[model samples]
Target chain A: MDLTDRPDLAYDVFAKACPSRGTLEHVTGRWGALTLGALAEGSLRFNELRRRVEGVSEKMLSQTLHALERDGLVHREAQPTNPPRVDYELTPLGHEVAGRLLTLIHFLEGRMDEVLGARERYDTARGGR
Target chain B: MDLTDRPDLAYDVFAKACPSRGTLEHVTGRWGALTLGALAEGSLRFNELRRRVEGVSEKMLSQTLHALERDGLVHREAQPTNPPRVDYELTPLGHEVAGRLLTLIHFLEGRMDEVLGARERYDTARGGR
Candidate 1:
C-alpha cells in the first residue's frame, strides 16, 4: 500500500473532502494523541486512562475513546463483573500509529532545549512579545 | 537521546505542565500539520501555501506559521523585491518533524478504506448514527 505510488486511494488529506483528514484529526487531536500514547503501553480501564492522560476531563476522555474506537484504532471491552469492568487498548493498527506518534514525540522531547532556545531568540527579536 | 532510558529529559508530554505538549500541539494541530506537510515538499509563498493546504483561511494560516516559526520548526524568509516576496520552508528540525508527520499521513491515507469500513460497522452497530 504505497500511497505515494497509488492514484486510486482517493484519500488525499490535502484535499478538503477526504475522509482521511477526519481520521487524521482524530489520531492527532489533543486528547486523542495522549490517549493513544498511554494505551500503547498496555490496556487500561476508564479511570486509569483518565489518570494517565493528565488533564482530560471525564467527558472529553470518554468522547476521545469513542472516536478512537469508532475509527477501529481502539478496542473497548466491558465485563459484567461485580463492578462492571471496562478496559481499553490499542488495535494492531493503533499500535503502528502510536509507534510512529511516539517516535515523533520522543524526538521532540529530546530536542526541547533547541526548541526553547529558538523561542527565546524569537521572543527577543520580537521585542519580548 | 533514548527518551525511554533517560530520566533527565524532564519533558514528558503526558504531564499537563510539560512544554513539549505545547510543541506537540503546534506540530499536530489541524492547520499546523497541514502547513508543515505542505512546506516539506519545498518552499512556498504565503498564497501558494494557502492554496496547497486547501481550507486554511488567511488569518489561521498566518497564525499557524507564526506559531511554527516561534517554535523553530519553520523558517520565514522575507525578500525586499519590488512587490516583496515571502516564502516558508521547513528548517532542518522542521524537515525531520515533517518527515515523521508525512509517514503517519501516508500510512493513514493508504488505510482509509479500513477506517471507513470501521466507521460503517460502528454506525451500523449504533443503529446508524
Candidate 2:
C-alpha cells in the first residue's frame, strides 16, 4: 500500500512506544546497517556476509539477519544442498531503505577528515578526553 | 571541501577500525537519531530538546549532544544569560546528515504497517516469539 493512500497511519518515531522506533533501531543498528549495506551489492552467503561486515560475531550477524528478515527488509534463501546453502539479499523495500542509508553512510565517509578535525579540536579544548 | 576533491579519503564503514563506524553509530544510535531529528527543525535549549525527543533521559541526551558536537555534526551554544541558556542546533554538516537520516526514518515510518505485518507472520510461523 502506498503511503499517500493512508495518511491516517502516521507512525511517529519520536513516541517512545511506537513500533517504528523498534524497526528503526533494527534498520540503523550497528550490525543491521552493515548487513543491509553488504546485501545491497548483491546476494551473499551467510559466511560471506559475516566476512564483509567485519567484527560482527556469528551470533550478532544471525540476530541482525533475523530482525531484518522479520521487518521485511531482507530475504533469506536456504537451499537444500549438501550442507545446506543459506544466502541473504535485500528485498525491493530493502533496496530503497539501504539506498537511503548508504547516502548517509557515504556522506559521513566522505567527510571523515572534518570529523577527525572536530574531534581533535574538541579533545584539545577539553584537555583530552 | 567537496568529496570529489578528496578521493584518497575513502573511509569504509565496513572495516572494523574505521573511525567512520564510530561516527555512524553516534548518528544512528537509539537516542542520537531522535536528537538529530528534533534539532533539524531548529535550534533548541537542552530542556526543550529533552522534551521534544521524548523518552530520552537528561544524561543520555547530554551524552548524545557531546558526541554529535565533537563530530562537528552539532553546535552547542551556551548563552550568557541570567541562568545561562544552552542551545543545541545542527551544524551545516549535521544538517546534511540529518536530512539524509530523516529520509530513511520517514521511509521506515511510512512502511511500518508492512513491517508490523511481516512481524506477525514471522511470529506465527515460529509459533509466536
Which lDDT tens digits does candidate 1 get at residues A49-88? 9999999999999999999999999999998898799989
Q: Pick the candidate with the highest TM-score.
A: 1
Write the residue-wise lDDT of candidate 2 on B1-129 in tens digits: 674676755688999999999999999999999999999999999999989888999899999999999999999998999988998999999999999999999999988888999999988988997
Weakest 10 consecutive residues, lDDT, candidate 2 chain A? A1-10
Docking class of 1: high
lDDT of 1: 0.93
RMSD values, in order shown: 3.2, 3.4
Candidate 2, residue A53: CA error in Å? 0.6
Q: Score residue A114 of candidate 1 by CA lDDT.
A: 84
Candidate 2 clashing pairs, residues 3+ apart or interchain: none
Q: How does model 2 fare in lDDT?
A: 0.93
- The residue-level lDDT of candidate 1 at A33 comes to 90
Residue A129 lDDT in model 1? 72
lDDT of candidate 2 at residue A116, scale 0 to 100: 98
